[model samples]
Target: MGRTKRKRLKKYEQNSINLCYEEHLVSLQKWMSNKGWKNHKKLSLKLFPETGRGISSKITVGANEVLLSIPMNIMITYTTVKLDIPVKNIFTIHESLALFLIKEKEKGINSYWRDYINSLPEKLPPLTWLANEEEIESFPSDIKLNVEYTTTNFKNFLNKIRDFIPNNSTLADSLLKWAYVMVNTRAVYVDPHIICEESSLNLLKDEPSMALCPFLDMFNHNYLSNTEVSIINEGRCLFYELRTLSSCKKYEQIFISYGNHDNVKLLTEYGFFLPDNCYDNIKFTLDEVLKILKFNLDNNKYKFIKEHDLHNNLYIGYDGVSYNLKAVLFIGWCGVINRLDSIIFSSNYPSLFLEKKLPDLIKGLLVIKKNEFTNDLRQIMSGRIVTESAQMVLEFVKFRIDFISEVILEYR
Candidate 1:
């Protein structure tokens, strides 16, 4: 009796029942097989109720285990793209990869990486720039301005690539957006110096770290996920490896960290957020702080703040006000003085000079910000909230209100 193998297979069958049956995934699994992807044997795509499509393992995976190690030839890079124009010279690696997708998609069945492209969302959730004037009113002040800037950049990119687009179609607007978001959300970092041609990458204004890795991007993100990514080069052979830093039992959804992004950033960049994200924080520019607190800084104080880079990274998280924010508040009140380094460096130093006024001020700022979020929600939900983008924004607004409300309640 082969009891050992039977027991293991039974355990596997329990979680394997929910395996994805989508044609795209089926084809992708086949493609990976043909491509000789070397990953954990039990790793497979699963449709989870909560997180949608994610990577799962049939058996327990230990720390430092290599989850997926994709070959370089299969990964899509700027070199992988082919277009009539000097696209590499004109566009960024990100844009080039996106354009590669668009061109490949136009080829239909003849397209390379068709199965991989099919797995992508037809359209990423519409973002702030896509919102109507009414809907834009609901966005946070910081996000609203960023949306405007992003819209302008999008237009600029559109103009530059107008010649390549067929019939000069406005239809390509959605297509282009879909392509760009697909790359932006899923692209992984690769060391270009070792793996790419420096001269070719130099033409693009941005860093050459971006590369699209098939099967690898399937892993969903968790702010807390600890995973190690590396490039393995063996003379003519190259590999992209992703390893787990933490152990996981069978049937658990595996996640990777997308960096220590706050809720605002995660929402803006990925169109998603975790309600209980430890990285969630309320951010403020120096001007926003002054406006909210009704405080003014002399040029010297402003100069001091900027000189120390204390004006940036000013935010309130679950742990309370950030060090930079605290320092900025103290500097604004007390003005820049001798021994300011000691004062800023030492947390207790500011407390000695300040009373409850600073704490009260921070709470006031949170209260006002919460009210703005509440008002934004009112405008957003006024109508049916039909679009996925608006719905995402609404979720973010509600979360911010609750977050701020909790902070205000606890600050006393």
Candidate 2:
């Protein structure tokens, strides 16, 4: 007798038909209504209940005749309970709602959601056309505007990275390390026109708009792949897309329960964490940490001592928490990378580079040294500060020395 073949439905086929039916929709609608989603009209209810690529259900809701599409995914993983939701809902509905619904909810929102929302906007005018000659002339022009990476410099940087990675560092570690030097050493000039709406308007002679998110900068996978992604006309609202995955525990449970035994073996062979679903969580956590750091820096609570008089070694303390020199610089650099043509820096001040790029570079360097250090001698140079140049240099050198010494001692 021939061996019996067991019949089974394909994953997508199962998902297409796995709709929760009217009963579940009604319950969900009620839940939405309770959460103040008034004037809800069910546009269309589609389902893909299976766990795989693009496996999700989309519910379009009409509120006061405004159509809002809600795409949701239920992921079963080992370490987390994951629910992918639309970013607009966080602003439109309630951020706390997702947390309340998901059991054993993780600590933070998925980074993909932010990316998705940010990518949804239409492209705005470039920054070069926005400013007048007088207005633009008033801005700093001393900072090197268009520094390009030479082939030799790029290769040298890559070699340095490769040399460090042999110590068993992860991809994120290497990338972070590179980003620090790229920004600080002025190996690459961050275009100021890309940083802010006012700057974009003034420098580019274009209407003010926000910058798009760069792909390299945005490592999260769930961001909508094919959106224009830009800022609003007023430059206040930014949007993008995001897709989230199941938690590690939930993913493993689903994989095992669904008889995907080979997946476990394959993941193991690739040196991946057994619970593959946790990757998204890790990425999100890192992004959140960076954002928090940016926020703290912007608020001025993070203080930086600026040398006002280089000759007298006189220094003035600039509070990052209340004032935003560094934050402005960072935002500007990020904007430039996003290719937002509508933003520009008017002034040619080299000091902006020092203010905006150095702190984060230092922080990133510390992180790398702590994780992977091989006695590679590194030196950083600062611009001359006539008023407090000596003091600033001394403080910067001391900070770096202390940090390096601490890391070396700790690892030793």
Candidate 3:
């Protein structure tokens, strides 16, 4: 798969997509400027039709140039927040930050990160964790199971920190949910030692090193975007420097990649998925493969697969079937393996008789996967699960079926 070709947005859609946050941006710029933050002369905040709100390079930005150099002081992390003894001992980085964000949001203008906080949306796109019964029902079994698991864990965590939340506030849980999403979706990686105090770092239950960078979070993710971020430490000052690995022309949206993630992961985490994501893999569990095969494997072959951990990476993507998948199926087809190592790892194995039967073996799985997508899409399209983020999920499902069909055709 390649990058999806986007159609130009109509006038109204363009207006809607570009959220009106000019005043927030202005205030943030002023506040940031005072804190030793000097934005690149050529860069400005923009609402791109394709990627929503992001930074645009007004002039051509050359490779290796600094796009953004945000100060560490301006970032909200463990270092910035005054963590209480209880929170500092029990909570992870994300949990502590979520609690802090909620408290800060209560401070309308008093908060130091007020402008940056104001710039963020009250709620992000509809996430799987927030999906109600009706909305979750439309999701595929795999996605449904994950959503259920995530929702349970989220509620359990909230229960633990309910004491910090005000009893009178009606929007407490939802506010906490928003804060959780805010931290997970927007927080960038930093070394734990860089932010966490040595005294409390070890006491924290989990290791989570992340910082909420103000303007830097505005740069939306693109898997193909080549950018590198590091801390620039001088004797008296420290700056979070983001360098461009590639050039950007005038008025182009400059992207920084979070990481190489597939549509499924992106959908679950961020409530959005990139179309034609090259990193996508149609993964199947051990039971799923067993169900698809619907044949009892001999003890010897089963043990061999289990021993080698060949059952773990059963997947197919744009490239082709995974080596593990091929090896697993090959074991089923062959009567005797003279050399176990050679049969599984040999380069010449693909040219063997197993190659003749591989396509047939995979076609069944593809058909099943395609059917799942079609069924999920049909349910989502019924208008029951109404949400903008559900629409993104629907779009991804539609894309997946078409993508699988193409792969099936190629395999033929």
lDDT (C-alpha, whole model) for all candidates: 0.75, 0.26, 0.76
Candidate 3 residue pairs that clash = none
**Model 2 residue 351 lDDT score:** 67
Those runs of model 3 whose alpha carbons end farther than 4 Å from true positions after fitting are 1-21, 163-171
Best by lDDT: 3
Provide the TM-score for each candidate, comma-separated: 0.88, 0.17, 0.90
Query: Candidate 3, residue 305: CA error in Å?
Result: 1.6
Say which prediction, candidate 1 or candidate 3, comes out ahead on lDDT.
3
lDDT of 2 by residue, 168-227 (tens): 244343333333222221111122334333422232222222122222121211211111
Sort the predicted structures by lDDT, highest score first: 3, 1, 2
Which pairs of residues clash in candidate 1, taking residues 3 or more apart in a chain or in different chains?
none
Which stretches in model 1 have alpha-carbon errors above 4 Å?
1-17, 82-88, 163-171, 335-337, 346-357
Candidate 2, TM-score vs. the true structure?
A: 0.17
**Candidate 2 or 1, higher TM-score:** 1
lDDT of 1 by residue, 81-175 (tens): 63333544567777777778887887778987898888877866556566676677666677787678777767767876885555656446778
